[model samples]
Target: MASGKPIDEKVRSEIITKIRDEGMTVTEASNRYDVGKTAIYTWMRDGVVNSTSSLILENNRLKKENEQLYNLLGRATVELKKSKR
Candidate 1:
C-alpha cells in the first residue's frame, strides 16, 4: 500500500504524543494508522530528546573519576608491593 504523502512534523508529533501520553508503542501506532517503523524513527530524530549539556558533563565527570580511581589504585598497589618486600 502506497502511503499517499510524507507525514509532516505536526502529524508525527501527534503520533508520538499519543505514544508518549497514552503509553502506546510505535509498532502499535504504526499498525493502527498504517505508519511505518522507519517513519516513526525519522520523526523521533527530528530534534526530539536531543541533548548536549548533560552528555558533555557526564563524559567529563566519568573521565575525571576514572583517572582519579586509576591513580589511587596504582598508588595503593605500589605501596602494598613495597610493604611486602
Candidate 2:
C-alpha cells in the first residue's frame, strides 16, 4: 500500500489486533502491509488507530486539562507560601 493512501478503519483495526494478539512484530506487520512501522506501533500503543470514539478523545483531553490544572494549582500554592513567609 502507498504510504499516503489511507487504509480502512476496519482493516487497520485488524492489523493492530493481529500484531497485539498474534505476537507479530511491528516491522513484520509494516513490511507485510506496507504501512509505516511508526503508525503500526502507534496503533498498538493507543489501542485504536485514527480513533473515532468521542469518549476516548474526550477522556484524553480531560486528562491533559487535569494535569494543567494540577500544575497551576501547585504553582499558586507555592507562590502563596512564599508571599506569606
lDDT of 1 by residue, 1-85 (tens): 3285776655766777788789999888888878887777766666333343345578899999999999999999999999999
TM-score of each: 0.46, 0.51
lDDT measured at residue 10 in model 1 versus the true structure, 0 to 100: 59
Quote the positional error of residue 78 for candidate 2 in Å.
56
As a TM-score, model 2 comes out at 0.51
Off by over 4 Å in 2: 50-85
**Tens-digit per-residue lDDT, 30-80, candidate 2:** 889889887777666676665635556889999999999999999999999
Q: What clash count does candidate 2 reach?
A: 0
- Give the clashing residue pairs of candidate 2, or none: none
In model 1, which runs have C-alpha deviations exceeding 4 angstroms?
A: 1-4, 48-85
Clashes of each: 0, 0
- Candidate models: Cα lDDT each: 0.74, 0.79
Q: Residue 56 of model 1: what lDDT?
A: 52
Structural RMSD, model 2: 7.8
